[model samples]
Target: MHRDIVYASPTAGGEQRDLRLDLQIPRTKGPKPLVVYITGGGFMTANKAGNLDERTYVAEQGYAVASIEYRTTTTGSTYKDGVADVKSAIRYLRAHSAELGIDTAKVAVWGQSAGGYLAAMAGATSGTDRFEQGDNLDQSSDVQAVVDQFGVHDLAKVADDFDPETKATYMAPGSFINAYVFGPNSARTVVTDHAANRAANPATYLNRSSAPVALLHGDNDHIISPSQSLILLDALTRKRVEGTRYVVKGADHGDLPFLPDPEAGRKWTTQKVMGTITRFLDRELRS
Candidate 1:
């Protein structure tokens, strides 16, 4: 049976914002890896109940899936708040690892788009306790591996090269991310605020301690450019960090609906993405 778990106030200001998780457990007594799945909405609209259909499919694959809801730009303009919420979710799950039947040692964090960024962050910062406050050491929120699909890894770099002539038009109202992160200056400051931009970026924290990551992105994505993934892969390689990156031939950003179509290039690329993720996870978790 599926369970919906609530984690109350993992952090200081999270008292009013309890995290909701959709836990899907397979009907087996044997131990299985716990996959923490994060949904993508450009850091704006998705929640813990991400695409229920997909959750069911993933559960049928013989793994328990925990779909997480994190604080979005809608809750705050800064990126730290969202990052804080994800870290809190991990801690909450780890704290209840026994009750939830979570194989904490084999945890895999996976997500798409903004959620992908969070997954990568969770894996990379597994050993760091930046989100912990006071003296709570009972929880172990480390991630063994990461699966990032069209996730945004670099914000400062993206902003620096954002189309100068049409930056305003691109981030206008109704554009989910624009509406969520910047209400008034959604168009202007996304390109203007240097300090704010840096603080909201994920690439700023990369180091040798980061966990292994598998990246899947579309080469033709206009929103979060493929260049972002390329840069991230390059950095990971430079640091001698284990990582895998694949660029879909023609798929757009977050367009899973267009996958594996015989007429489209995504058909071939989708197969590669699946193999890469499976192999990466097997090596990271079962090794």
Candidate 2:
């Protein structure tokens, strides 16, 4: 496990913040395929070590798992900066692949909630010059595949699939989504600005050259509707990009049925839910 490795020091809000990542490498002899994991915190906070257990499991499957930290709302950064930070981290990893024992040819990004949104953007916007900023400019930030878990794809139409109560709450003026899209406490709704909404939507960037994507969403996810994944899949299909969707039944946003809970005898670990992700990564990265 390599901890607190500074991937980039990009300027955000007139201050340069050093972004770091914790990498868990497998015990295998050869350079391993990399899986970059981004955590979910409503786009406000990010912890690189937040999903260590799950990431370690992926490392055990012979892949290097890197849990990355990106600039968030609390850091005075918006989705655009967050996307750039993700790409910068990828470029940094690719630049240091030889020393890090990473297989530069094979790379994937996986994330939940807000991070998942960024992951989808990373995959959909591959080769896009705008998001590919910061250090390691010569290296490509293009990933081979993407695993988006309950992420918001279309920011403008996110409320279209939400329940009445959820829509009323999330689309409120001072909601987190507002803060995420606009500034921290700006009096602006996410869908109000058409151009900004389209810029933030991952589906808007989909093309034939975009990486294949595997979207996993819980049917019972009230925070992010399952229809969000469908929207992305639809765009992928239209663009002739390979896309797959898995709607987990009876699973909430980040609850027991979707994630593992040993105390509740929930075995939705590597053999089940995680297995689905590993299999996709195997096919996309190892094949």
Candidate 3:
């Protein structure tokens, strides 16, 4: 089913900033699992329509996909707001589970770069209880698994060790992370604030209860660095959580060549990683 896109309700402030959501389902008669896909644009550039092709590919594999639009990292929207939007989108999906024709419990999340980080946050953290401004704390919007591609794990960790060259490349207004997580309020020192950054970084929340994770990073990534994945992998190990990490050789951040060979990249991304995610969801959600 190639369904049209829909928008959820606005935030608490009455901004018309609705979350864009789309559904893609295969032609199969029986129901299938759902995958909520978030895009990577440092929280500013991409939208639900922007990544329809990839969503279609996943849907063709007999899974339903929900693509969401979060507040941009540059449009004065705080990082917390973006996270809230994703959580709300999942709530919307669960609320409409019958109409969407998919198992609400079987949903997983997948994203690249900044979006990946958000996906991880969605997986690790529970839905809003108080910290989030517009969160519906009562909603059960948690995800079952996560696929993080070159996403940041520890914002404070990366901020402290950002190479000078990387800093120059990300010459926004404040520090790269400041601009990323805080937007123009980069000077707010949220990166160093244990309460703030701790809530934002997925690494800080990993524990025995965390969903299984699949982390893919390019060994040559200059953006978030391959070490980002290593950090999360280490955390997962420390917590005794099931997880997998794949370091693609020679690939830069978001570049295809840096992945294993093209064929392997396709297989690893769509088949191997997807399979692992599907199996994990089966175990966690279906079991």
Candidate 4:
């Protein structure tokens, strides 16, 4: 376990902040594939150690898991800033692959909710220079695969898919989208900011060369509708990109069934869910 490893120091609002990652490497013989995990906090806050147990379980399966920190609304940052931070972390891992025992050729990004959105952005915009800011310019930020769980793919249409109550809250002032994308006080909501919403949409950057994506969403998710994944899947199919979708029955935004039972001292994910993710990652990164 490597804790608080500084990956980049990007200047924001005339002040520099250190971005770090907590890494767990398997006790394998050679360098292992890397799975970068991004935590979810409604794009407002982030903690690298949020899902340590799940990451450790992935590491135990002969892979290196890196839980990364990205700038969020609490840091006065936006979606673009978050994507830049994620790409910078990827470049940093590749640059320091030898010392970190990471297999530079095989890397994937996995995230839940807001993190999932960032992962989709990173995968869709691979080889593009739009958000490749920070150090390690020589190393590419292209990921082999992406695992997005209950991510908001299209901000423009996301609110429409939500229930009436959820939509009302999402469109209200100082909502998550308002604070994270536009300024906290900005009158622009996801409904009014069509251009900004399009800019932040992962589907806007999808191409034939984009990384293969595996999307998982809960059917009972009210915060982020299951239609979000369907929209992304439709985009992936349009581009002829390899894509897979999974709908977890009877799961909520970030609640039981998907997460492990804490009372049982289990890891972050359940055995069945983790197995599904592992197989997809193995097919993309190990095969």
Residue-by-residue lDDT tens digits, candidate 3, 112-199: 7878888888777753342344444455777778888888877766633467766444444466466656666555554346677676
TM-score (all chains, Cα) for each model: 0.81, 0.93, 0.81, 0.93
Point to the candidate with the largest lDDT: 4
Q: What is candidate 4's CA lDDT for residue 16?
A: 95
Task: Tell me the lDDT of model 2 at 159.
Answer: 63
Worst 10-residue lDDT window for candidate 1 reads: 257-266
Reference-based lDDT, residue 51, model 3: 46
TM-score rank order: 4, 2, 3, 1
Candidate 3 minimal-lDDT segment of 10 residues: 255-264
Model 4, runs deviating above 4 Å = 255-268
Candidate 2 to truth, TM: 0.93
Ranking by lDDT: 4, 2, 3, 1
Off by over 4 Å in 3: 1-4, 12-14, 127-138, 159-162, 168-173, 190-195, 255-287
The sequence of per-residue lDDT tens digits that candidate 2 reaches over residues 100-127 is 9989797899988888999999998986
Query: How displaced is residue 82 in candidate 3, in Å?
Result: 1.6
Q: Which residue segments of model 2 deviate by more than 4 Å?
A: 255-270
- lDDT on C-alpha atoms for all candidate structures: 0.66, 0.83, 0.68, 0.85
lDDT of 2: 0.83
lDDT of 4 by residue, 1-287 (tens): 99999999987656899999999988778999999999887887788878676777788889999999999887678899999999999999999999998897978999988899999999999968879898999999999899998888887666676678888788776788777778657788767878888888999898866899999887877667789999999999998988999987776676222344443223226787789899999999999
Q: Looking at model 4, how many pairs of residues clash?
A: 0
